[model samples]
Target: MSDGYSLTVELTRGGDSNNRDKMRATVEADTVDELREKVDALRDEMQEWADDFRNIQPEYRRELPDDQSQLGEVQA
Candidate 1:
């Protein structure tokens, strides 16, 4: 059996050529430890973004009810 580990993602925004981006990285090592190190780094990066959501300003964030009463305004 073979263990495969690699990731590639393409991103495009606003139909702008300048906004096109691609990330190509891989873990080709046959050892599990090396793969864990790579995966841990990815986890850390993703966590940083997760941590950022709290720092975003209220206006830039999705709106939520100010109280139990306001929650009904968005109900279907």
Candidate 2:
């Protein structure tokens, strides 16, 4: 008598079920509607993370010369 539903998924690239990654979890709820709401919330949180990751940028700067003689003076 299980009160919750269990889900197990395996992902394979080349049709080899044995050589794949697996994820298993159980969702507990009083009703099917509750389960759907929980799953949708999870989806929304994942989407937020994806949106944040898309905004990454690199900072760039030029290195100063180690030798003072090699450095050039700035013009006004």
| Residue-wise C-alpha lDDT for candidate 1, range 1-76, written one tens digit per residue | 2776554422222355543333334444456777687767876765565456435543555567566556556657
Worst 10 residues of 2 by lDDT: 6-15
Candidate with top TM-score is 2
Error of 1 at 8 (Å): 10
**For every candidate, C-alpha RMSD to the true structure in Å:** 13.6, 10.2
User: In candidate 2, what are the lDDT values of residues 1-76, reduced to their tens digit?
Assistant: 2676443323223245543333333445667787787766665755665455445444666766665433465444
Q: Give residue 10's error in model 1 in angstroms.
A: 16
Weakest ten-residue segment in model 1 by summed lDDT = 7-16
Report the error of model 1 at residue 63, Å. 12
Q: How close is candidate 1 to the true structure, as a TM-score?
A: 0.35
